[model samples]
Target: MATPLAALAADSAGDVAHLIETALTPVFMLSGVGTLLNLLNTRSARVADQIEKASDLLDTEQDKEAKRKLRHHLRRLTRRIMVLDISIMFGGLAGAMTCGAAFVLFLGSVRDASIALWLVALFGAALLSTVAALAAFLCDCFFSWDNLRKSGPLPKSVKKRSPESSASTTG
Candidate 1:
C-alpha cells in the first residue's frame, strides 16, 4: 500500500490548478442551469396567477376551456421546477466528487509550491460554491411545492388548520 505521505506528492503547480479548473466546470454549469430554471419558474408562476385571476371574469365555455389549459400548464411547470431542483442537487454532488478527485491527485503529485496554495484556495472556493448551489436547489424545491399547493384545492384536513395549529395536531 502507498504510504499516506507518498500519496500526497504532486509534480507541478500547473497540474494542481488544472485539476481544480476541471472540477469547477461541472459545478458552475449545473448551478447556472438550476438558477436559470428557478428564475423562469418564478416568472411563469406570477404570470399564471395573474391569468387565473383575470380568468375569473370570463364566463364562456371557450373561456373556461382556456383557463383549464392554463392551469394544466402551470401544474406541469411546477413539476418541472421540482425536477430542476433535484437535478441541481445531484449536480452539486458531482461537483464535490470531481473536486475531491482533483484534490487527491494534487496531494499525490507532491510538487508543493505557490501552485499548491492556489489549488487549496480554489478547492475551498469550489466547495463553497457547490454548497450554495445545494442550498438554492432546496429553496427552489420548497418554493415549487408551495406554489403547487396554492394553485389547487387543499384537502379538508389541511383546510381546517387554525392559525395556531401545529403539525402534531393535524397529522
Candidate 2:
C-alpha cells in the first residue's frame, strides 16, 4: 500500500512539472509584448514632438504655403499617433490574456479540472490580439517612412558651408 501511495505522489509531481513547462511559452510571449509596447511608446513620443513643432510653426508662420505644409504635417502626425495608440492598447490586451491563460493553466492543474477548452480559448485570444497589434505597428511604420521620404533631405540650415571670409583664403 505504501508503494502504491508513493507512485501516486510521483505521478502528481510529474503533472505539476509538465504544467510549469507548458506555461513557460506564454511567459516568453508576455516578454515579447512588453518589448513591442516600449517601441510603440517611443514612436508615439516622437510623433508628439513633431506635432508640437508643427503647432508652434502654424501659430507664427505668415506664409500661406508654409502654413498649408504645417497643417498637412499636423494631420499626418495625428493619424500616426492614433495608430500607435491602438497598437499599444492591443499589445496590452495580448499580455493580459496571456497572463490569464497562465493562471488558468495552473489553477486547472491544481484542481484536477478539465480546462483544455478554456486554455485554448485564452491562448487563441492572446494570439489574435498580438497579431492585430503587430499589424497596426506595421501600418504606423509605413506612415512614418512615407513621410520621411516625402520630406526629402534635411533643410539647408543643417548643411555646413565654408565661411565667406575663409573662401578667399583658399586661393
Candidate 3:
C-alpha cells in the first residue's frame, strides 16, 4: 500500500494545481467572513460603550424625563447588541462551514474520490449561513439608522436677525 505522501506524489501536477485553485475559492470566502465578523464585533463594542455611557448617566441623572429617555435609549442599544450577536454567530458559523468544505475538498482530491455530497452540504450550509448573517446585519443597520435619525439633535438654525445681546446666542 502506498503511503499518503506517496499518494500525493502520484497526483498529477495539473490535479494538484486544480485542487489548490479550488481550495483558494473557499479561503477567499473565509477571509470575507473574517472581515465581516470584525465589523460586527466593532459595532457591538460601540453599542456596549453606549450602554456603559448611558448607564453612567442614568446613575447620576436626577431628572425623571431625562432618566426615562436614557433608559429607553439603553433598551434600543441592547436590541442592537442582540442583533449584532446574531450576525456574528451566523458569520462565524459560515466561516467554519467554509473551512470544513475546503478540508473535505482537499481530502477528496488526495483520495481521488468524489466528495459531492459532503461538498454540497458544507458549501450550501456556508452560503445559507452567510445569507442569514447578511440579513441580520441589514436589519441592525436599518434599526440603528432609524434610531439615529429619530434621536439626532436638530442643527442650530442660522438666525436671519441677530438679537441685541446674549439672548440670541442662548435662544
Q: How do all models score by TM-score?
A: 0.37, 0.80, 0.81
Worst 10 residues of 3 by lDDT: 153-162
Across 26-70, the per-residue lDDT of candidate 3 in tens digits comes to 999999999999999999998898888888878777677777778
Model 2 CA lDDT for position 142: 93
| lDDT assessment of candidate 1 | 0.53
* Candidate 2 lDDT by residue in tens digits, 1-171: 345346447687777577568879789989998998899898899889878877876877767777777778888889999999999999999999999889888787666678899989998899999999999999998988898799742111212345974687776
Q: After superposition, how far is residue 40 of candidate 1 from its true place, in Å?
A: 16
lDDT for 90 (candidate 1): 53
Please give the ranking of all candidate structures by TM-score, highest first, separated by commas. Answer: 3, 2, 1
Would you list the rank order by lDDT, best first?
Answer: 3, 2, 1
Q: Per-residue lDDT of 1-171 in model 1, one digit per residue for the tens?
A: 565346435336786577667666645654664565466456546645644544442322244455565555445555545555554555555456545646654554445334545555655655565566566556656765766676643111112344566666777
Kindly provide the TM-score of model 3 when superposed on the true structure, using C-alpha atoms: 0.81
Give the per-residue Cα lDDT of candidate 3 at 4: 63
At residue 66, what lDDT does model 2 achieve?
70
